[model samples]
Target: MPLQVAPTFRDALAAARRPLVGMWVCSGSPLVAEICAGSGLDWLLIDAEHSPNGPESLLAQLQAVHGYPVTPMVRPPVGDPVVIKQYLDLGAQNLLIPMVDTAERAAAMVRAVAYPPHGVRGVGSALARASRWNRVPDYLRTARTTLSLYLQIESAEAVENVEAIVSTPGVDGVFVGPADLAASMGVLGEQDHPEVVAAVEHCLRAAKAAGVKAGLNAFAPALARRYLTAGADFVLVGADVQLLARGSERLAAEFIEEVR
Candidate 1:
């Protein structure tokens, strides 16, 4: 018994009575991740998609944040089962899969994260930190409960099928990717476009209808607050690199541009 460690992310989210605010860890630096983890955020998403993070980098980030009170999540490049398996082995229990556009795909993701007889996650617990090297008693039997699967509704097709996708048996939550949804709706680089906002609201409503947690990614404060007001249970507010870029720009503006 590893002291009951901590509540699963799914359990924690379900227990939360208010919306959770999170950020992206795109820098792939363990020290940076630890800083963010301790900065009082409710959660953190370690991105492998659109970021340079690989398994090793992700492993380090997870280890760095392991002692924090925040829930650490992982977003694989895609929802491939093998990649999911690798992340799970590396001890990622909270997963946000990108580009899931259909109920079928969503169900496949559910299966991919589970073990045999119920789903299809290959068993390697004894060789992995996921079970704390089999230290977390009955790891295989209880793995499903400790896991949270959030499928990203990022396309027009996905938005249309949001109801079915959220209704899938093992889907714990649905995440709306505003930028990708905008691009899918032929409005690339305009995540705040009216049509995209409407679509995101629709997905949020669908998640509420299905009784599953709804999440969104919004770097803009207004947009994040808007989605939160519309029933988003969790939101990714910013990225590490984005923060650094903006902060450095501000410094340069003050120190260099001001003197010019």
Candidate 2:
């Protein structure tokens, strides 16, 4: 069978008529990932940053969602080049790098994913699923086009450098993280704080002005809408674990009261 490169998150955004709505698959379970993949959302973020996912589990989840229509993006725990290379070799075409607080860091991430001369991604296509075990023609040369890289602006420093960060070459997009931005602003757990909102908006504007895609992780309907209205090109509006948590709670609330 001929191997085909999938559409990247960048391509999806450029082609999308509206903001691409997505959710987080944080449970580290392939079953949960499969369920979320079929939910008709435009994308799904398979989180390894805050979830219990290891390389094996991440690979399983990625494989599980391969047949679905949703675009699966991965969030590695850190922006280390070694880690990025690992995830890339594991077949994560879309990546959301957390805690990128400066343009230098953003540039480093670019080099981390690119092949040497352009950058320094290690050569191991034959052993990598990303190349379909050497079946993908010109895999090394065309890998960049098939990939999308979004850096997370989760701290005060990142917001302060928002313009430069968005303007960095090879950074496909920036995904503003209000939750951590709130923490960095000393308003821990208050994602909707006015100050955090302002910071988030600052990033949105910078990305849009630079012609780079901007995204947000907003679970609340109102907040997600607000970010979208603020010019977010894509938004993660829900999560698999949260739905189960809230749904099961609601069911228990009704049944426990009647059963006891």
Candidate 3:
């Protein structure tokens, strides 16, 4: 199948009759991006907030993923409109905004992703990679449909306002940040803490009730399966950096053992 011009993450979810598996690409390397694209994964998240990916690096990564089957989604540090616009203009079909704590904040995120009337995303030159560098003049007409917006409910405040946040217009989905959420819940370093688990389940229930997709970041296959069975639509398995670190460590350990 030809690579889609502007495929939304939600579109991918809708297409996923079964559970979907995604991997986080925090390393911003072209080779890594290419590998993930060619892998059988449904989508790849280009993490900018926690990664060392400046715009240049992100451009290269996006280029590397081009022509592959997996869609590219970006998670900006915060849901700043300028940052969101820049990434969207750079060809990110989907956006995952972090630390959404209220319905108003969720609305702001939606506005940043949308055009006028629906939201306040400023429109200008579609002469960017997102529009195939001026290849598509009807970009604005189909932009909304092409873009997906996900709000991260990763804080105590967010869990409290989960219902309102998920009900906001243009909010496509919710992603749980277990680490941050655990900290926010005053149970730091305990992802499986009862309070944290309750918060996550609450968020899931809210998403289901509102008829929106729910997502979770699962670092292990077992955890990924658990989330899927618990009603998560999308599950992020691992990150490029973490995978590399683990592989290198294991290889070095094996070599040392052999030498000994």
Residue 220 displacement (Å), model 3: 3.1
Clash-forming residue pairs, model 2? none
| Candidate 3 per-residue C-alpha lDDT over 174-218 given as tens digits, one digit per residue, 9 for 90 to 100 | 999999998987888888787887788888889999999999887
* Candidate order by decreasing TM-score: 2, 1, 3
Error of 2 at 181 (Å): 0.4
| Native-to-model Cα distance after best TM-score fit, residue 239 in candidate 2, in Å | 0.8
**CA lDDT for candidate 3:** 0.85
lDDT of each: 0.91, 0.93, 0.85
Candidate 2 residue lDDT tens string, 8-94: 888888899999999999999999999999989999999998999999999999999997888999999999888989999999999
Least accurate stretch of 10 residues (summed lDDT) in model 3?
A: 1-10
Candidate 1 vs candidate 3, lDDT winner: 1
- When 1 and 3 are scored with TM-score, the better candidate is 1
1-260 in candidate 1: lDDT tens per residue?
A: 67334566788787898998899999989999999999999999999998889999999999999989899999999899999999999989899999998999999999999999899899999999889898988889998887889999999999999999999999999889988889889989999999999999998898888899898999999999999898889999998999999999999989997688
Worst 10 residues of 2 by lDDT: 1-10
Off by over 4 Å in 1: 1-5
